[model samples]
Target: MGIILEINGFKYFAPLSSFKPKHKRLCETIDFIKVGIYAVINLNNMFPAPLNLCKAVQIENIKNEHYRNLVRAKYRIIKQKTEQIVNNAKDVYNHKMINDGKSKLSQRCNDFRNLELKCKEYSDKKK
Candidate 1:
């Protein structure tokens, strides 16, 4: 999972999704980032994932060579665009906040503001 630039001081995580047949039909936008033909980083799915709840992946421990290599390659690509990805995520958040499901992307996106409240509540309860 990769993080969005901190929103309200809370980090949000979004996942790289496998390229669907439908993805090929659509164009990449602020909420959708295409990673060549391998995968797409769907900013619409981003949500507040607390740092403590996230564990580091042991890429070296992967038993499948092909899968491991694919992950590594994807990581390198994503790593190179860390700044862009962070900015895109922040943009997605702001877009959703303002759109409030008015836009098609916002309808699919997790309620970022609401998720932040839930994240804070969960953290407070745990503490």
Candidate 2:
């Protein structure tokens, strides 16, 4: 014989042979000796495919999407920020060249136009 008790959502099970002869009060009890019997039978059919392969595909898809998005964002930020930095440097260089009389205004203007074309090409590629 066996007895099971559920008190405050916790279960306690004991063989009836263990309860002493002097103990008389049992608040509530049931007979459910083998709680794991059903689980033992159901576990064998739980996975139809190889568990490692299934998990590998799921993890790979998630990681691939995350890395793809991160790389694309990194490229765009680097491209745009680099273009801005180069344009600022070109402005300083143009000012210095003009003040030092090292290059004519036409040459500085041509360099600026080329920088603009490169920026436009980058923007077009992004679209």
Pairs clashing within candidate 2: none
Each model's lDDT comes to: 0.81, 0.31
Q: For candidate 1, give the lDDT of residue 31.
A: 83
Cα-based RMSD of the predictions, in order?
A: 1.8, 34.8
Please write out the lDDT profile of model 1 over residues 1-127, one tens digit for every residue.
4534566689777877887899998997888887767788888888887888877778899899999988788777778877777888888888888999898978988988889999999999999
Model 2 vs truth, CA RMSD: 34.8
Candidate 2: list runs displaced more than 4 Å: 1-77, 101-127
Q: What is the lDDT of residue 41 in candidate 1?
A: 89
| The 10-residue segment with the lowest total lDDT in model 1 | 1-10
Clash count per candidate:
0, 0
**What is the C-alpha lDDT profile of model 2 across 1-127, one tens digit per residue?**
1222222222222222322333333321111111221111111011112112222112334467775564444334434544443343344344533554454433332233334355456556666
Error of 2 at 118 (Å): 27
Q: What lDDT score goes with residue 68 in model 2?
A: 58
**CA deviation > 4 Å runs, candidate 1:** 1-5
Clash count, predicted structure 1: 0
